[model samples]
Target: MGNSLAAIGARHQMWESTSDRLSSSSDSCGGPVVSFGQALRSAMETRDDPESLGTSSQDLADVDEQDVADSSRKSSVSAETAEKLCTIPREKGLDAQDFRCAMCRKTIGGSTFSKFETCAIDSKYYCTECMKSGGKVSIPARVVMDWDWRERAVSDRGRAWYEANQEKALINIKTTNSRLYAHAPALEETRKLREKLQLVSMYLFTCRESVSEDFRRRLWPKEYLRSEIDVYSFADLIDVKSGALQRRLNSLLKHSINHVMTCTLCKQKGFCCELCTVNEVIYPFNTESTHRCLVCFSAFHVECWRTSGDCPKCVRRQNFETRRAQVDDPHNTLLVLQP
Candidate 1:
């Protein structure tokens, strides 16, 4: 009987082991029968109980949702921080809304604020520190080389010298008929120079005089003028004058005409003498030889006098012989001297 009992116990233990294996496999694969290791691994992978795996389905879901929320929060925070940096005023020791620093009374950095510091005592936009430290920045007025005419004017002694000697800086005019026509050559050239000077001078004067309270009150103020003038501005002016003078001189040298052509007999190109006119002496005068007018220095054809009513060369010349005869003896004396 004892031996029979021992055999029955052994059979029961084998059956129990088989049952445990089947239960584990069914839980892992949702099916019957699997390898022990595979069943254990699968059970671990799909385990949902918090007590066994140190986590639950609800807890994992909560962690994933929390991660997404944290990432979104970080992105939003970064965007807000960037916007704040962009909006912040760059000026030291000043708030965004304030134009002046409360502690230092200096101008704050902002689009709407003036760059200059203000003094409380003088009610002026100039700081004591800046004034004390200045070599030239403290000066009320600035000298710009490009627009120095007015600055020179302000310094009257300098202006007077410039005004008196400005013409010497100009280019001279050239002409072929230097003897007969006095005004045409120099006057024309000087007129052109004067025009150019006037234009440049006007521009300079306007710029110099533009600094005013009324002008500054506008939407956009002019740039601050530095005290020292640059050498380049004066150099540019000189260069312009030199170039113009050189070009004109070159043109005059290359294209100048030396002489003029004119009529020979009766000393006129038009209104021939009564003797020549009545005789029909059209071919009596030479047209080939070049002759310049003594009075006007113009050139004309000698044969042109046959039909011309007046002297072509001497358009403004008076018939003083007729006038003088009228003054001297009325008219008979002129006829006697006519031959």
Candidate 2:
């Protein structure tokens, strides 16, 4: 295993345990969660500084000196406590933490479109911030296996190309087969082309060598069909595994006999009120909100207007407009009117 896998070596085990806690059904985030370093950092951000807590500048200076003196690392925090900070519902508003980033702990309810990102390997929530800055993405066994098969296929193609061109190569024509005489310019062209192909072939082979076999089959099922591409593509619609009550409502209650599903957002299967939602996944026609976003054109529940922030798509548009105004400042280059 590489250093990146060693980093999550501990937490990945806890994430797998979510299956045991799946049926908790407590009207909140249901299941185990990830590391809580982000949540702890958020708590510290909200705390008042010592200056506002009735402490003098001189006294604060003394306390700060003391804290610096005792800066040695304490005993390691319990792994159990660290994991607990990742899951929540202790308070009413905390249900939002279900969609919190596994790394930064940024919660989702801040906007209509959830900022929470899903891990392709374990199906856990990782925010976009963590993915970009944090480092190499770690995959569980299942996904790594998929990559392995692809690598093999690429290698086979490269080998076949070499076999077809080996006899026609300029070197072979010059020494072995004197009948096929080529002038200097033509030989140069053929040599350059072969070198380029060889470089590309070696580059792909190196990539396969760097990856380990440990991450083969993680979250995806054992029996999924591997298509010409991943037989399972991004646009492919999957049928939901229906529950008894949902079936009853469809048949006996004369409702639109359909399905209720749990989408694997960021890989983990849960409700995060983002691109994948109860209404968006299970019932497309019965939208939660009637008002469609001006940017994405997706409907958001009317209650979005009352929230502290706007929809994610609209927020993106506003940010773009603001940036344009700043960058195109009229005074930056004086435009004298050509009267």
Candidate 3:
């Protein structure tokens, strides 16, 4: 078990490094590095910075350095708390010195240790006294992973803290807990549908036909699905499990398909199978039935493209170019053939 935890931690570190490089590349390309987590944080009220509390040296002199240090330490501890206990390595026994009520900073051990309850989302311990004063909340992790919205008990401070940040879109299960997708077939299915919806959205927005702004807003807010397809918030996951998001995606896709089939501008954007005599207009979104030519980028029936060894369009273009070169300069020592 220790080995497994170590391996997971190593992989997470590697992924973080890769993400850092990608972020740098995105910045270099002048694209905004607006991730799903960033969007969630932006929606919440800004946090107060301990150092920024004092504007001048006179104000700083009046402040107690010890208080600022304690606040900083507490903030760091809170931030280190994992959303799920499974993500971190843990032991069976609790140490009084190590464990404390996350809310009140009360030491949790001795006779009352067994009676203490844990927060489902943050996995923090709460003393019996704190638990008595707390309320119940639908654990965000349970809602996203299990589609379970049943309320669970937590300390009052925990409840208030959760309410302050519940709307913040922190967990992205696909990247964080990929094993869930394998075990939970429903989640994987929803993910695939969402990806297809992304493709459909691209087609609709890029087409010459003007899609209604209201419909776009209803489908997915610009903040959520801006330019990336994989980024999803807790709200999105919840909606998917509840069938609301899936229904919206289906409606939008149906509209897009109808527009493509009927509108002259949209139809013109489609490609025809050049490899076969059977003529049909195929869109890029139909990945199952059509294959695109590598060189000319024309769509063709899957079987027809596979049977033909090479792209017929490229062959014909090359032959025509060669013939034209001979006709233009028959006696030329060197003939330049266009590729």
Candidate 4:
């Protein structure tokens, strides 16, 4: 009996030590903790009456159900509060909600709740602890919109997500937020010039001119070439805002245009404005003077296209089709000579 009692005491001491550790961990995580005494009392009550086990189980079920309901209610309320906070005007500031770390959802900012750092992306507040714990990151939104390369404080998880997706062509300023154009009109012009450069690069790609090498190197990176004009990575956007990208595009465009106009091999790819009698070579990149036919893809002078309202190549193709059809018919005995 003494040995059995000693064993029970040892087990009780071990359980107490484990419970103390558990209590400390739970407190750190802001989770509920049931003390060793309460747990022991509950177990004793259930053991005292064999019939009371079912009642105790039912009570636990009730408590679990109540906890679930409360958790759901809190989640819904948090979602609604976040939505309202997003709707609030930025100029007015978010003084309504108590300052808390956006990353850990921890209560921070001391007594006044005014000491905090803002995330560069959404301007959300974060605590110094969160910032020290891997919160510094470059926001992709600011990189794409403003070409900001400076890192700012964010949640650790948020920083991880951004670093993982930094290379992706995810942000499309044209489709997502076009108001940036209204704010910075020069940016719109830059995009337009880039589009034109994209077209010009097509002509330069097949040409044997020495400038083609320069064009390939300077006419945007290969990854960026796959994306539309509005889509860009942080590195490319930074280069653009720094004026290096624009300078390269201008130099390449000028050289490639000169090569296309002068080189015989390059001119073979050019189109003559058939809509008019002008013998000058025309290309699609010459947007000011040339108009490309939508149906036949033939180039023509913009003024000639405006007057005729038809493509000369398209008209010739239609006439040839008509003659071929007539010749194919047995009813028409005339032999049509193909041009």
**Model 3, span 5-74: residue lDDT tens:** 4664575565545533321012221233222222222222121334433365666667798979998997
Clashes by residue pair, model 4: none
Q: Which candidate has the highest TM-score of all?
A: 3
lDDT of 1 at 149: 21
- Cα lDDT of model 1 by residue, 237-299, tens digit: 333334654354333222211100121211111212221223222111122422223333232
Instruction: Give the per-residue lDDT of model 4 (tens digit) for 175-284.
Output: 65577666555556567667666556555555554655666565535435422677654445555657766776677668767876686555555555655666555576
Query: For all the candidates, what are their Cα RMSDs to the real structure?
Result: 50.3, 32.3, 17.7, 33.0
Clashes of 1: 1
Q: What order do you get sorting by TM-score, best first?
A: 3, 4, 2, 1
Name every residue pair that clashes in candidate 1: 261-299
- In model 2, how large is the Cα lDDT of residue 256? 14
Alpha carbon lDDT of each predicted model: 0.31, 0.31, 0.55, 0.56
Comparing 2 and 3 by lDDT, which wins? 3
The estimated TM-scores of all candidates read: 0.16, 0.17, 0.55, 0.52
Clash number by candidate, in order? 1, 15, 1, 0
